[model samples]
Target: MFESFWRANGEEATIVIPGWQTMSYFSDVSNLCWFLEPEFAKQIRRLHGLVGNAVVEDRHIVVGTGSTQLFQAALYALSPSDALQPIPVISAVPYYSSYPAVTDFLHSGLFRWAGDANAFQGENYIELVCSPNNPDGFMKQAVLKSDTGKTIHDLAYYWPQYTAISSPANHDIMLFTASKSTGHAGTRVGWALVKDQEIAKRMTKYIELNSLGVSKDSQLRAAKILKVISDGYEFPNSIDAKFFDFGRNHMRNRWERLREVVRETGIFSLPEFPSEDCSFTGDRTSSFPAFAWVKCEWENAQDCAAFLKSYNILTRSGKHFGAGLNYARVSMLDRDETFDVFIQRLYSIK
Candidate 1:
């Protein structure tokens, strides 16, 4: 019984090579609310300028320490005004832990942790949905009970590497950050797609309150990276091949390695990953980059996470994602040599 619920077999996995750039870029931010330097502000504007007709008066852009900050701001904007009748914040379990925590910090005292949107009453919440969801990598369809019920889609990993879809404005209050795709976590820049003018203003207010204003320097750096992305220049590795190609190949190889690791051992299992063929007509089924979420047969994800950590392999357990306790999240950024060693270590276990 414990075998299914036991800790991961790859705990404390040595980090001989670093993971995503975001993991290491943000250790120095002592504070996040200060105004950015002038050039930095210009740079941020430049980056947003690359969006190319994507931004409109209806759309409000704000920089955050990361999408995490934006998420908080969006929640605050949606907070109920009347303390006596607070709007409920509902989310799936196994969700990004921040959702509930942010709900608490807003002190709305109205969040109801329902297992899924179906359980959430429309009148209760301005829903927060994470598509291409954190641990599972599954994208929730644009859903609405009626024309007016609110839903904020978190598309933090929706770049071409992860999904073929490029236009990110389809969802309401879309949340994104460079930390996931561009490796610029240090900039702490993020944005939200707010269809409501009032909510947009409130979000800006929250941003101002949270950090006075996001640093202009960080915003500038992010803007530079955005310009390069628009110009087809790679940030971490300025290779001739498209950055999306690099990311796709990199993640694809890692996922293959993961498959190899799991297949080599007779004791593991995986859910059938939805294929690109399953994508909508315009959706590209070509890639699922950014992460490798695997559902292990383990009964409890926390035990699986503990096991991985014991091996010095820092992994976020599935329970953290709000479902499938047997699963764990793994970064797909790995060199072949590191991946080989990781596989060897994984196979060497039991």
Candidate 2:
């Protein structure tokens, strides 16, 4: 959907990296693995401040190849090393599908997938809280209230384009990725804002063992992109500025159009989100979620993904996200032509 937008403003988003630049694996003087480039860190802070999406003060920034790596690092950092039993990792129902796999794939003795936090009764556990959640674009909070439980806030889609920047997020551990925020999925850069130094160090160690560290080239490119976004805010009226404005407007338009199509179908339903005041935009706006959580209401179309697939519209099955087969997720971030095709197929359903 944003292909035209990017094509029209390509020059402003372009970055040129010298071949010899960032040849070293090391990103900073800290010698610590998972070291974030100072410029990258600075740019991240600047971007957050400009966008009012996340709180950065008094936090240790740990960069990763992407949030996927950081999710593992968070599990490593939060789980006790000497524990006799595997630490339980959990999230609420309809959670991000990758959490279970990311937590259990290593078969590490330190942690194990514990299923839904809402159903869990464990004392010591790590709960992943996704606000403006993955499968469903709704705000979420920790369901487990155990004193021994630790929480990692995944604020990947918390940008103004996806949801209102309600406030600067302050948590013990918070994760953000470039993919959802700036549409830089290939950059493979994500960062965790950690409140504790020890946890930060341990997460860094996990990154060290995992891939040695994030790519410096990716970091530099991400920094440039973030800087461009910040500059857009600084000079809102500039010809090449206001990337977030463009993104938010485009997303809102797509959501409205999709809703119109779904309404006409009468076989699918979508979640309703109330408009809220955005700290970044200084106005009230409804959510323009990255994905559409479509629920099939027809008896014959019990499997939402299969139902959509029958119409040549592929989607992510809700069963993958711990929701029932009646639900499915459709990406709203595809190219305009693809989105048009999806809408056409969707409205054609009888």
Candidate 3:
């Protein structure tokens, strides 16, 4: 989706890295997070400031290999080293499937995967709150209400393209990724905005021990990409309309097409989201989620994903996200050609 947008600008968006440039492991030896490239940090803050999705002022910016690494870093930073047992990590049902998998993959001594924050037992825990959530794009708040329970806000899909920015998200720890934001998954760049300095330090330390710091090359590219995006909005004659405008319009059209096809089939249902006044767009618009939460309404369908597969359209069962087998997640972020084929397949599924 964003490929064309960047391509339209041509060399205006290109970056060149010399063999001699960014050779040092340390981007800023003066800062605690020495690996953090100064340019990347600046662009991260500038983009956040421009969008007003997350507060970046006076907050420590911790970069990662991607949001996946940042999430693990959060878990490591939040869990007390003196604790008698590993702290339970949880998110609500219909959460991002990777939450549990990533938390328990290593069976980390710092934290362990605990499914569904709503059913979580105990006082001390780490709650991952993904707003405009994955699998089903709904706004979320921490379900566990204990003072000892810490929360990490995953705002990966909180951009104007996905949902209305109700207000500036003020959270202890917030996570955002280039994959969702700019469709730069291959770049493997993500960052966290931390209000607490110690938590930021611990997260940075985790990256240091894990990957010996993030890739300087990736960081530089990410910085360049982000600067171009922010520049689109800041400078009117610089290039095109806001980078998000391209994303938002494309997503809205996709959602409309999907909903119409689902209605025509009458065998599937999609969750309807109420429209909200977006602060950025300054218009009342409904969220056009990057993922469509489709549930098979047919009585004969036992597995929604399998049913779609039989139709030669691939999908992920909602069971992966702690939902029923009747429900499935269909990504709306695929290529235009692929999406057209998917829609046609759904129409022929009778």
Best by lDDT: 3
List, residue by residue over 105-214, the lDDT tens digit for candidate 3.
99788898989888889999999999998988888888879889899999999999999998889999999999999998999999999999999999999999999999
Model 3 lDDT, residue 142, Cα: 87
Model 2, global lDDT: 0.88
Alpha carbon lDDT of each predicted model: 0.57, 0.88, 0.91
Per-prediction TM-score: 0.74, 0.96, 0.98
Candidate with best TM-score? 3
- Give the 10-residue window scoring lowest on summed lDDT in candidate 3: 4-13
Better of 1 and 3 by lDDT: 3
Candidates 2 and 3: which is better by lDDT? Answer: 3
Segments of candidate 1 deviating more than 4 angstroms: 1-58, 109-115, 142-144, 166-168, 233-241, 275-285, 298-302, 309-312, 334-341
Q: Candidate 2 — which pairs collide? A: 1-334, 1-335, 1-336
Worst 10 residues of 2 by lDDT: 25-34
List per-candidate RMSD values in Å: 9.7, 1.5, 0.9
